[model samples]
Target chain A: MKKVKVYVTLRESVLDPQGSAIMGALHSMDYNEVTDVRIGKYLELQIEEGTRDVDTVVREMCQKLLTNTVIEDYRYEVEEAVSK
Target chain B: MKKVKVYVTLRESVLDPQGSAIMGALHSMDYNEVTDVRIGKYLELQIEEGTRDVDTVVREMCQKLLTNTVIEDYRYEVEEAVSK
Candidate 1:
């Protein structure tokens, strides 16, 4: 099996209100050193060896359902998995 | 400034309902190769140079606010940022 890790982040042009809120909270808590905060999604997928290569399958999934292409960007890495 | 990338994931003991839902959707769409999926949070913080070391500041933030210690675990990496 292979484990694919996908990271989905908002487009650079997008404004992350959630992140801004968190930054503001931190500043209030005395972490004034933090200038900015941006939040994103991280996903890990375990795939059994299939007909297509793992890379192809992951890319297809990302584009189809894992991310919103218009306002978000996604990237992934595949690693060997330790089966249970 | 330094950019700290923090990934917060549920503990192995915790369940990920969202990940399971996505996996089910993928299978229904004929992507049966995926066996399991887990979802987590990815955060990036822009930190100004402070009196304390970056590592110390990051750890404090993660413990106090970025992650819920009981159910989630967090890890981070720091990279130099291009000032605007």
Candidate 2:
């Protein structure tokens, strides 16, 4: 089996209200050193043992359903899962 | 300046309904090769130029606000931000 870690974030041009809210909260909490924040999504997928190209499968999944490509960008890391 | 990438994931003992829903969707789309899916949060923080230990500050943020200690675990990667 293989494991894939996917990270998705808003595009640079997109506005992120959630991130702004968190930034405001941080400032209110005296974490003024924080200048900016971007909130995103992380996903982990466990692929069953197969000969299929895991990278291709994962990227397809991200593009098709895991993210909204119109406003978000995504990247992923794949690793071999240790058997039990 | 420094940028911290935070990944927050649900604890192994917790149930992830959203992930299960996505997995079902994938299976409906003929992605039976996928065994499991876990969904989580990703955050990026931009710290202003400061002499304070970036690692300590980032970790504190994760523990205090970025994650729910009762059911989630978080890890972070810190990198120096490129000056424009």
Candidate 3:
């Protein structure tokens, strides 16, 4: 078996309202030293078969369907796991 | 300063399509022993000042704005750091 981890985050240029709101709230709460806030996604996937060229396939998946390239950035890592 | 970490994940009841696809990919890659996969989000926010009652404020922020309570679940933690 194999495990793939994907991380997705908004592009730097895009304004993240949720992150901004959190920053504002933190400031009001006396955590007045906060500088930047960024929000992103993390995904852990378990794959069934142990195949060759897994990295290429996973990268393609991220580009073609898993993420929005225009406004979001994604990176994935694949690791082999012991079969049980 | 204070740091708030928020983790957002799809409710167990909801189907995670991206996670499913990654599982499928893993299967095709010869990792035939894999089972369940879950996907979620992570956020790191920095606050400026160190105030009292930070936990309550951060929790409220997650409930009110940092996450969508309908389909997603969120948890957060707050920590104090040395001012620079």
Candidate 4:
């Protein structure tokens, strides 16, 4: 089996209001060393071996359903799954 | 400046309904090789070097605000940030 980890984040040009809010809150709480905070999404997928290459499958999924390309960017890593 | 990447994931015991919904959609769209999906949060923090250690700061922020320890687990990686 393969385990795919995907991270989706806002594009540099986009305004991340939520992240800004978190940073403000942190500063008020006296964690002033934190200069910035950007929040995003993390997805873990379990896929059984199939006819398609794992990389191809992941790219297709990310392009089709996993991200909003207009404002966000996504990257993924695939690895062999060890039984839990 | 230092960059801290924090990943917060739901504990295995939690039910991830959004993940299930995404998986169902993927199956309907014919990406059946995918067997499971889990969703979580990814946070990127820019921290200026200060009197306190970055690791300690990250751990404190994560415990107090970034995640709910009751139902989530978090891990972090600290690295130097390349200028944009």
**What TM-score does model 3 achieve against the real structure?**
0.59
Residues B2-41, candidate 2: write the lDDT tens digits.
8888999999999999999999999998788899999999
- Model 1: residues with Cα > 4 Å off, grouped in runs: none
DockQ of each: 0.93, 0.84, 0.43, 0.94
Predicted candidate 1 versus true structure: per-residue lDDT over A22-76, tens digit per residue? 9999999999999989999999999999779889889999999999999999999
Candidate 2 residue B29 C-alpha distance from true site, Å: 0.6
Winning model by lDDT: 4
**Order of quality (DockQ):** 4, 1, 2, 3
Candidate 1 clashes between residue pairs 3 or more apart in a chain or in different chains: none
lDDT of 1: 0.94
What is candidate 2's local distance difference test score? 0.91
For candidate 4, write residues B1-84 as lDDT tens digits: 999999999999999999999999999999999999999999999999999988888999999998999999999999999888
Query: Chain B TM-score of all predictions, in order?
Result: 0.94, 0.93, 0.81, 0.97
Output the TM-score of candidate 4: 0.98
Task: State the RMSD for candidate 4.
Answer: 0.8
Q: Work out the TM-score per prediction.
A: 0.97, 0.95, 0.59, 0.98
Error of 2 at B56 (Å): 1.8
- Among all windows of 10 consecutive residues in model 2 chain B, the one with the lowest summed lDDT is B49-58
Task: Give i-RMS (Å) per prediction.
Answer: 0.6, 1.1, 3.7, 0.6
Candidate that beats the other on TM-score, 2 or 3, i.e. the better one = 2
**Model 4 residue A2 CA deviation in Å:** 0.2
